[model samples]
Target: MSHSRFESIGAYLPSKRVTTEELVSQLQETPEFDLERITGVKERRFRDTTPENGEDSFALALKAVQDCLSRSQYAAEDLDVIISCSITRSKDRTKMYMEPSFAGAIARTLGAREDTISFDLSNACAGMMSGVYILDRMIRSGAVKRGIVVSGEAITPIAETAVNEISSKYDLQFASLTVGDSGAAVVLDESVDESDRIHYIELTTASEFSHLCLGMPSDKTAGVALYTDNRKMHNEARFLLWTDTQRNFMEEQGLTFKDEGFDYIIHHQFGAAAIPYMNAIAEREFGHPMPPDLNVIEKYGNTSSTSHFIVLHDQLSQQSIPTGSKVLMIPAASGVVGGFLSTTISSLKV
Candidate 1:
């Protein structure tokens, strides 16, 4: 049976990089600020040139998709599916939903056929993985020959708000300053040779933990109340707390603390603080130290769903791993955790 394979991957980071010092300087000038700690985040990328109003997630997806098509030999007309997976959206103050429909706008921007499959998947940080799995099933069923999964996460605004709120409430300075912005894209197709395609994908969920990390719509009433009560800010710490659950899931996958059966490991970036713990767990389970370069947390920060693809794109561009290498792409979303094991097939060279 033919299998779905990732043919190419691409990523785009905004030209404007805002360092912690710069952010602190700006914040200090305001009445609500004071001395702060930036933790380990050196800087984060922001769009150098934005639309008159602003560049939303859809626009970011378009630019990244264009780059993907240019780097690979694929033409716009050859694409059979387009999936826009992002946590952010474009909307007006009065409008309830984002304008232009993310999937439709991306399809038009890429000159894809009207009949081509197009849609948006909002799975928080696991959106891209969900999109990939959906497309994989379609290709396996002969519904489409080629598909693209794109994510444009301009989480800076939310991060900014979350950080400010967290800092104001808890008197903590480092956590809010570590968030960053990024975008990424991936191209998948049916592989004529099963040897070069996605081999296995396992997904598990802990819905009981769904409330751990959440983004509630802003409410004037609650906003005013939260300003005085610090307890509300504690939810922001959910990302850190979720690490224990992720470790448990990894163990269940038979990926013991030190197993090295997999040649490459790509995971969602949570920041420098989380990397050492994950690396240590992998080493303990695998019985060997993970390569220093295995971590991408330092540069990109935490990009939610785009984190894994960003690392994959970087590794592929550098040819860091040889063809036929076995790589594991792992991502742990707020309520769900997923593991995808794929082989770097020889066909990827062509």
Candidate 2:
């Protein structure tokens, strides 16, 4: 049975970083809301928008791919597949791209061969993981040998809209202010052994809660926007998404929290408090608490599709997470789509 593993990882954060204090200063007209206190995001990187040295999503993705390639064994033409999972494609900063696939364009720029299967996948913030899920299945089925999943999210437009248009604390677009911009890439190849291999990947959607969060152009501001019903979506029901999707699988495999022996839990970096809240809920429902939670929300904010990967990269870079560590990841997306990922790594290089 052929399985896949993340052979290498890469991430790119723009040089322009905005502290929560700076963000607050930008919205001086609006009443104060302690952003850091609310979302646990002290600062977040933003793609340079300066004309002389700015980067579109495509450029950011390219840089991330270069970073990935530097740490990988494969060259440009060696990849069997290249998946682009960015939610935003800033072709010219005025429009989001959709005609030719961003993945295809990225591959072309990278000098990848024509034989490479280049495509794009979007599933809200679950976009990158969705690509991982597909590539994992393909590798297991012997349809492909190597692949790369990458994403570049320039989500600050929504934050710009929210800062200028928000009139009161009750505005639905409050969540938009917490997002940042970043690019991430992961290289996957057929596994040689148990170490550094992906164990499980799946995505479950609760469409019933789909209406709770939305991203669109702002009616009041010039930039894009996001509106979220925090009261309804963050309640007990949304947190139950993981359990509802996994009960059957867990029953069949006789897997419990303690039984899985996950050394660390890296949930989507939506917010610092939300993860701990999830841990408490899991303990109440599953009869065992989750493992120690790893996060980077304090510095990186929510990089959307790149959230979990950012945490992985940060931990691995610092050597805080040793090889053979049993890692469990949960992805949180606005479509109310989410799932768990398990992996063990013998060594994490970049």
Identify the leading candidate in terms of lDDT.
Answer: 2
Query: For candidate 2, lDDT tens digit of each residue in 321-345?
Result: 8888989888888888978888887
Assess each prediction's global lDDT (C-alpha) against the native. Answer: 0.63, 0.84
TM-score of 1: 0.77
- Determine which window of 10 residues in candidate 2 has minimal summed lDDT: 26-35
Weakest ten-residue segment in model 1 by summed lDDT: 221-230
lDDT tens digits by residue: candidate 1, 243-285:
3544565677665534535677776665554455655655654
For model 2, give the RMSD to the true fold: 1.5
Q: Which stretches of candidate 1 lie over 4 Å from their true place?
A: 24-40, 49-54, 91-100, 167-176, 219-260, 282-293, 345-350
Candidate 2, position 314, lDDT: 86
